[model samples]
Target: MIIIFIASLILFAFLYMVSRNKYDEFIEPLDEKEFKIKKIMPIGFWVMDKINYRYASKYDRNLLNKTAELNGGVYAHYYLRVHWANKITFELMLLMFLLFINGAMGKTDMELIIFSLLVMAVVAYALDKDLENKVSKRRLSMQIDFPDFLNTLTLLINAGMTVSGAWTRIVTDTKKSTPLYSELRNVMLEISNGKSEIGAYEEFAKRCRLPEVTKFVAVITQNLKKGNSELVDILKYQSKECWELRKHAAKRLGEEASSKALFPMMLMFFAVVLVVVTPAIAGLIGSV
Candidate 1:
């Protein structure tokens, strides 16, 4: 076990040294704040680039690209590859650490091997789960912010502003930089850069990838096409509906928070019970 650990450690060091300079281009642009795995990214890139096997399937690629697009903007494709590489690289590092620990402890049981493998699997699953959670949080943020944007846009349009002008006003005047607002800013940017309004809105919907945003974009595009006279009324109705949805989302979040707290509360209750009863039981035992 010790020999294996030493050899593996040497090999990893060699790989890291050889690949660090080779993959600096890919690793340098990754922001540590946005990417938790940025530190291991050079070795990760090497693993992805040098490993001959196809680690990601077509379905995996599509799912990753979609998820990355939501989080990574224009660099979605690059990020998808980086994420996969980082996952595998991190798993390999963990496995090496386990090997070293086993060597040092002189415990080479089959159970330990199985446990190490399970840990690797758990880490892999956890990384993917974290990414999904980020996407979910982003969607929730956009959902929460959507109602205010709709109300503002409706007001501006009712006061005789064109939809484009109203959208620009709301986006420009807002100080909040939420996901919905950022996407709103993107749409205006595209339009200002010569994209058609309908096209820009469609792209915005794609980037957002939310049903609520999709419905809102559909209404706007329809208005642009057919010139809906009751656009303000329609927007007002949607805004009210979105506010209701936001309330429901908030309630659900509160319930989730309470449930999450329940386990700790249970533990504390048992601890207090033990503290209060243990001395009394000890006295009774002494008397007996």
Candidate 2:
């Protein structure tokens, strides 16, 4: 009893000491050689990684890469290292939690271990979901900003600027720190570094990896290389299409907002009904 508390305390103290020494060092697998799977990781990591990689086939690499890119992860391996490191931390933390729970509550070893693993599984799943949510947020930002970008480009191009010039102008003038504008800024830098207009546009499309953006880039590239004629009309068509997509996105957002509000709305309704009925029910009970 008292002895168990002492043991748990010592175990958690040792965990803190281990975390202080190992936490930052484990997360810095960012050097060039870190990707090469040789001597950079901890000693026993190879065994754990061997077990982890067996399940790696279950996840989508392209989706993971895109999510990583959205979060400024240049290489997929950087995120992988962070994920595994965090997972290990969770494992240790949950093990300690189970130990403490067992010591404090007199739970059996099997019961505590099973409960801990179940909780750890849920938390681990939540970590993957967090990445998916990040990707969705970036996509939403890009969708919301794309329409304004198209309108601005059309306006500048119609105002006697070449496509490349209009693009650079928009990149410089816009103050919105969205993913779309950030990518545009990158494109602007690429152009400034002597990259051709077509190449920059192509890279932007690839980085964005959106259907609408890819289509728009293809339009720009085609018009830039071939003779530019009726470009304003083409841009106007794109602007119209962009506005339609924007409206659709807004409607979807509204629907999602309404759906989220339903739970709170139901709670409020139940509260109001209870307020009206509670006194009546109490009076009836007293009479009976």
Candidate 3:
């Protein structure tokens, strides 16, 4: 027992040392060139590149470039992979500890361990799904509110402000009300920090990942490039379209909700009838 305890302690110490080393490695600062090198040097990047090359060969390379640009270039991919790998490694260690505890307790049932793993897998899957749903709902709310935001921009533009100027105004006006407002504020800062207006807009669109925002960006980008004067009118039209779509969506949702209530409503009605009729039938039988 003493030997086992010592061995366990030594194993834990080794894990702690390894973890400390990895943590230090992760936290080490890199110069911009080194950052770029590490970003491109990961095994994951080559795999992703090959996959993207094969799958999206037909699409405009510009789209991929745009995505990478918004992500702060290819190095962001390396950071993401490193983070994911660390998480996996941590989870593996946890599983190993659980197994080790079971072994130390002389509980060597493979079936129990398998069942525990399956339960953990299910729990993790459920948590992931819940998180995904929450994110989707938040994104949908942002999309729903975006047209009002666009109209505000149109108003600002019509009042003689440039596009970037309008964004700055919107950021100031709406920063307290919504996450989208906060995001726009950050974009304005990026613009102020030497990023071009188009680049900022592109980043915003990519972050939002809504088709409406993408279309709006594309239109606004072209208009800006051509020095078009009718941008306010275009924005107004888009805003109106967004409102109409929202109204239609609300109507459809109302109809579906009513449909869902129908079955439960009928069940309740039938239950009430049975309650009323049952007493009457029992009294009739008693009288007979």
TM-score of each: 0.93, 0.78, 0.59
The residue pairs that clash in candidate 3, if any, are none
* lDDT tens per residue, model 2, 195-220: 98899889888778778899899888
All candidates' lDDT scores? 0.84, 0.72, 0.63
Rate residue 37 of model 2 by lDDT. 24
- Highest TM-score against the true fold, candidate: 1
Residue-level lDDT of model 1, residues 1-288, one tens digit each, is: 888899988888887887778877788887788777676667777877777646478867765656664664567767677777788778878978999988988868888899889999999989888778778888888888888889889899999999999999988899888888988998899999999999999988888887878998999999999889888888899899999989987887889899999999999999999999999999999999
Among all windows of ten consecutive residues in candidate 2, which has the lowest summed lDDT? 35-44
Give the local distance difference test score of model 1: 0.84
Better of 1 and 3 by lDDT: 1
RMSD of each: 1.9, 5.9, 10.2
Kindly report which residue stretches of model 2 are placed more than 4 angstroms away from their true locations once superposed. Answer: 1-63, 72-75, 109-115
Q: Any runs in candidate 1 off by more than 4 Å, and if so which?
A: 52-59
lDDT of 2: 0.72
